[model samples]
Target: MADEVRQHMLECEARTWLRNGYNTPERIQELTLMIANRRGQVSAERLIEEMRRQWRRRSEWLN
Candidate 1:
């Protein structure tokens, strides 16, 4: 479905952003707002939080 594809693309974009050290609060907030505008506030909040948690875990493992 189109929605599924969009969600996947958003996830990929978020991952790329985080991987590239764009995980700062300002960047996350900007991304959250962008996604929320396109999707919904609840979904955007949940997705960003999940991505942040995953990124943190990876960072911990690396360090």
Candidate 2:
């Protein structure tokens, strides 16, 4: 199903962030909750966009 694919992609991306040490515990926790609450209820594009926004904010903070 499309939702399955989206969830898979989201998990993959989260793993990448974890592997790269780009995610903080708090951020990871937040994302986990967001994904849990939104999966099936929201589109993959929207979820990824939210993650991207978080990534950008973190990047800005780091810079």
Best by lDDT: 1
> What would the TM-scores of all predictions be?
0.60, 0.38
Relative to the unseen true structure, what is the C-alpha lDDT of residue 26 in candidate 2, on a scale of 0 to 100? Answer: 76
Candidate 2, backbone clash total: 0
lDDT of 2 by residue, 1-63 (tens): 999997667655744664456466676566656666767434434555556665655644343
Query: In angstroms, how far off is 20's CA in candidate 2?
Result: 0.3
Which 10 consecutive residues of model 2 have the lowest summed lDDT? 40-49
Misplaced by over 4 Å in model 2 are 25-63
Best by TM-score: 1
Q: Tell me the lDDT of candidate 2.
A: 0.59
lDDT of each: 0.75, 0.59
